[model samples]
Target: MEAPSFLDFIIHVTGLPGYLVFSWFMILVIISLALIVRSSLKLMPEGIQNVAESVVYGIYSFVEDILGKEETPKHFPLLATLAIVIFFYNIVELIPGFIPPTSNLNTTLSMALIVFLYYQFLGFKRHGIKYIKHFMGPVWWLVPLILPIEIIGHFARIVSLSVRLFGNIFGDDLLLAVVFFLAPWLVPLPVMALVLLAASIQAFIFFLLSTLYIADAINEAH
Candidate 1:
């Protein structure tokens, strides 16, 4: 057999969009969550039940710290779901041969758009007609100037969140691929450790930003 050219190798490796695995992973997460919920309903809390409760409590506390007691219960479910889903999506990249769903721009952008729409919906729901005032600045005179800036800033968050997440995961994925290809044995372990740390930090950052956005929508002045 003839040796493959460098261009051919690059084309072969980079041709696919690489999203089927993400879809499968998402299905797995949903089923796992369902099973976990079912298991947690036992008379006495044990194993998965205990773990689920602990995780729930921690998420609730985190939400309470940001949104206060009144809103914690209301927002906990969405926040917890986002935190867990994103965390899992990110950490999946650490497993050999598994690409994190979040490494894809489409996946990250969809998540970002979801958060964007959610906060906007919450703001309008909480503030009603008054939510429009949020873009109007402190005084009426600055409405023209402030409105555009505020609108841009809000949309910018979607791009920021999506791009930030996708860029980090994609870069990490590429770096790991290169390192593993080069060493394939010893050095990849330490690099894998770094990937794990980066994955965790990215997940936490996403969750934290999400919490802050929700809190802002619910509590900030119009």
Candidate 2:
């Protein structure tokens, strides 16, 4: 059998290399998950309902604790989104023939850029043109020196967010594969549990940091 060509390889590798395919795949999964969660929420408690309740309540509590309850419900739509999408994508590594989308730079970059745009948009909504003041810093004369630094800092946000997520997910998944191959027994089981924990932590951290970014944008306007 021949190795797949670069185009074919990328079709599956870059998460959304082919927008239609990946978009459809992700949408179907998301909708299914959403529908399932919706139905479960409507019915009596049992089975996955309890699990769903725990997760939903935990996420609400977590967001409220960090961002305040008033902010939590309003802001958590996006925060909850990032957490769910990322956690699922991270766990994709466990499925045969499926790769974790977060492992790819392009996907991670897209996620980073989306979050970047979101915070910027929210800043504008909160501050209008005054949001630009954030880049200008405290004094007008210092604008020349500070403007470039601020620009660099904003751009660096994309790089840092994308790379950190990609590196952690890719490294964790790779290590698990290697361990499983070498031991092929009970040892990898514990490590696999660690992978799940790592997945949750990574998702929480991403959501938390994104919230902080939004909060900072608002704080700066004051």
Q: Which candidate should be chosen as best, given TM-score against the real structure?
A: 1
Q: lDDT, candidate 2, residue 132?
A: 91
Taking all chains together, the TM-score of candidate 2 against the true structure is 0.80
Per-model TM-score, in order, reads 0.84, 0.80
- Residue 45, model 1: lDDT of 78
Model 2 global lDDT (CA atoms, 0 to 1): 0.76
Model 1 Cα lDDT, one tens digit per residue, 1-222? 111254234436767445544545566876788687885698777877777888878888988988899988887887788777877787776666666788989988988998999999999999998888888899999999999999999999999999998899899888877877787786456888888888888877888898899888877684
Backbone clashes counted, model 1: 0
**What lDDT is reached at residue 146 by model 1?**
94
Which ten contiguous residues of candidate 1 have the minimum total lDDT?
A: 1-10
Residue 154 of model 2, lDDT score: 90
lDDT of all the models against the reference?
A: 0.80, 0.76
Over 166-206, each residue of candidate 2 has an lDDT whose tens digit, in order, gives 89988987876677678767544688788878877887778
